[model samples]
Target: MKNSKRWGRRVLSALAAAAVLAAVPVGAAGNGKSKGKPPASSHRYIEVQLLGINDFHGQLNVTRKVGGREVGRADYLAAYLKQREAENKNTLLVHAGDAVGASPPVSALLQDEPTIEVLNKLGFDVGTLGNHEFDEGVAEMLRLIHGGYHPATGDFAGADFPYVSANVVDAQTGKPILPPYVIKRVNGMPIGLIGVTLTETPTIVTPSGVAGVKFIDEATAINKAVRELKKKGVQTIVVLAHNPGVSNPDGTNASGEIVDIAKNVDDEVDVIFAGHNHAYLNAVVDGKLLVQSYSYGTAFSDVDLKIDPRTKDVVAKKAEIVTTYHDGITPDPEIRALVEKYEAKVAPLVNQVVGTAAETITDEQNESGESALGNLIADAQRAAMKTDFAFMNPGGIRADIEQGEVTWGELYNVQPFNNQLVKMTLTGAQIRQLLNQQWQPTQTRMLQISGLRYTWSASRPVGEKVIDIQLPDGTPLKPDAEYTVTVNSFLADGGDGFTVLTHGTNREVGPVDLDALVTYIRQLSQPFSAQIEGRITKLQ
Candidate 1:
């Protein structure tokens, strides 16, 4: 429901660690005690501190709640990283992808250049590309990486750290656009880091943008890369992966795809850092370390790995996922200054007033079958297209709109990705199949519909579970008739398992998704209310 999933155990363990550490006296250290001189052994222990964050979406400035509490800004995140680096010499800061696009106005206005600038300044060692990174098209993505200038400052600066995607390849040439992996020498050890984005990139990203690119099997790519790295004599192998791992509600590892990848991957890989589902995870899977920090910089993960100098393999490791709270920590001066400068440059555009909301619209009710805000957004898209119905994935909605005067900034916050709307015609049978698929037990089949109503029994087998279906006008859906439906490009290209929508006829592009919503809201001066009633009913 929150458009992100994390392992519940990770969050609970983090909180538990925090609680236990808080109770101890300040000077008390855990079992990590070491003598002044090196111990007499053939192998040596080199402490490697890996700090990881993912799915930033280019938020540059701190956000204040209605009550003035601050959360996740680039500057605040930099401070957190700087503190950790100061404590360890063998430190590497990495991102697991989706760092650009879906950005706030400050970074969005500059086409996500500001966010990259901040990342470079913050000393990010490497990053994997997320599906959204291709939203601007592959050419634009390359331009941004090579010589793109920041929209806010007009300064031309390239990527400070290499961005890798071993799985994404050119369809015609079969060559990777960027290098698949890079070897970094950290404190006299040659560490091979392989970065891989999700194979679902084509389905989730705009088709035209990724027209000539093919995302290969992730496991295949990683295996191939690891073999090469090992041949090159690289001892320690770290994988920065942009794929989703199974997680429970409170942030613990759940048995899913990631577990299989960890257990079956080539033994050359020692650690796996993951993202895409935006869930927090810090668990050992099949004897390999797996971690995914929560999205939007809400938390950062610190993995302390002790590697044997002779074998270059991990001997002992500990991981802690820490939340970024402004209460006790002070912002790093350099990062704070950078954020302040960017905020000033984009102030006017970000502060503009947009519209009003009659009630609070939130993404918090993600676990439930229906969401008031998600329904309102789907309805708006349907109305804009003037079609038989509309459907929106809950993952597309990013932020919550409070009950009060809303600004264009607030609207952008809700649907920040700037995704376009596409209308297509589908047969009634195809629609039923699409509706039925939403009940899949795998959790990836859920759909957010706009102009339709249906009752379903999740307890039944997925495809046979739809009990009733009707059009927005309350007409019983005719299985043979063709109907025009409105949906975002993400789903039309088969994102979130809506392959049925891709089998439609007379497809046409409409307005951008967020633009359509903005237009609908601008036309209404009075506050509008929305509710999730029978749009999707769960029956026993």
Candidate 2:
């Protein structure tokens, strides 16, 4: 009562702060001006900034203790967008797919609903479908699309953005699973976004979930959709392709799938944002701008397109790949709070101690050629299947273990996805052919081996590359004898261009991948060390 005037001023300050916090920086009209008017150039040139991210895999925070730090998470991403809009009034945010599912415990607890809500809060304009989106099944995906709330949480917050998939069609009705394309007017420019997932979706996804669905040829579906959009007077077109990209071992863009797609793509499509292989790319293929950001939201791609006013055609295009570092940027408080809340709720399961590691296990060296981690995993699979040989893809190993101790969380980090281990028998000749294909220049053919030792000449051509092969007991393998081999379902079905593996005879062994690895680790109560000694030797 004695200091009523001071109390009034404090209340006023608090109200002012609240007002400032209420407005998210997304799509704010600059200079307090109306948004409907054309720029001073009278539409002479429309500067549209296309912001894209792909293969997020539900990582809601920065990865720590890797070679380098990676900054991501929905709120930090939102801050980045707001910063961009301040520079360019005409901006559109898009995703190239793999936005939901295959996430950590926090997201997995709610079936990735929290991630979707955060994406909506960040104002994603459009998104294509990724293979992981089908992890739960197509029906659930459709439910997620048409105003369905999370099964765990009874909230009514639906997808504020649109999901597009032109190639995925119902086998019986021959109709798209989702709308083939979405046309949006951004900054007064009518733009068309077409979505196309990989045709290999049939093999990668569960057969039952996609039982009545057929994924058409990507190039064919994209061309047809672009033509339809063009007929509707949409001159600028962007294709969100979930197919893999071509990249060199150095992480630089190479001329392969992207080039092939560009050559066959419709002329009307001005830009192509690609994903699925988790490659980083920014280049011009056949006069069209092509860009792919690295996976896990470690990077963001900003593409600027200058459109001609009269013709509505793109006159110029430029792309910039920006690495998201958590250091310089402050995490948006709201998003940080949400992440903390979810983390606390899921802490018991996510942070539960599992086991300990006697030595370091890493994926860094595993992808290059042969690796200790890969060898250990392959050995584990071989032991579980009791097979003649075993192979595990380097990309399948997600994380590393420290030397001092290991935990269940660490193992999950290594094999996060719940892929199944499948055993099959193949003729010796067929196995030889499969080994030969591993030497393909464009393929990441590094194989983790069990009960084998071999040397190869990198300079030699395909079939002649495998210089030697041996059984665990130091016996030469007979070309006529059949061998039982074990591999994850992904490779057994021709993932990573291993088409030869498809010729194997299905043995029908049922062992879940991550569970098998966990069991293998538990059996070895003592700390175990993996040596990369002679698993693979490159010829000089």
Best-matching candidate per TM-score? 1
Best by lDDT: 1
State in Å the error of residue 77, model 1: 1.1
What is the C-alpha local distance difference test score of candidate 2?
0.70
User: Which pairs in model 2 have colliding backbones?
Assistant: 354-408, 355-406, 356-406, 357-406
Off by over 4 Å in 1: 1-44, 62-70, 149-155, 246-254, 364-368, 472-474
TM-scores, one per candidate: 0.86, 0.81
Q: For candidate 1, lDDT tens digit of each residue in 1-540?
A: 012222231232343234224212111212121112223556468888898987787877745321133446777677777877877889999988888777787777777787888889988899888877786788768767776654544655667889887888989999888888999888888888888877756655656767778888888888889998989998688888888774442334455566677777787687888877766566777677887766676656777788888877778876665556555566678877877787787778777766778888765444336778778788789888999878887667777778988877778878876667889999889989888766544564446677788877767775888878987678889999988899887778776667888887798898888888878877775686666666778785
lDDT of 2 at 516: 83
- Model 2: per-residue Cα lDDT over 20-111, one tens digit each: 23222211211122123333654468788898988776777535321234346756666666666567768888898878665666666666
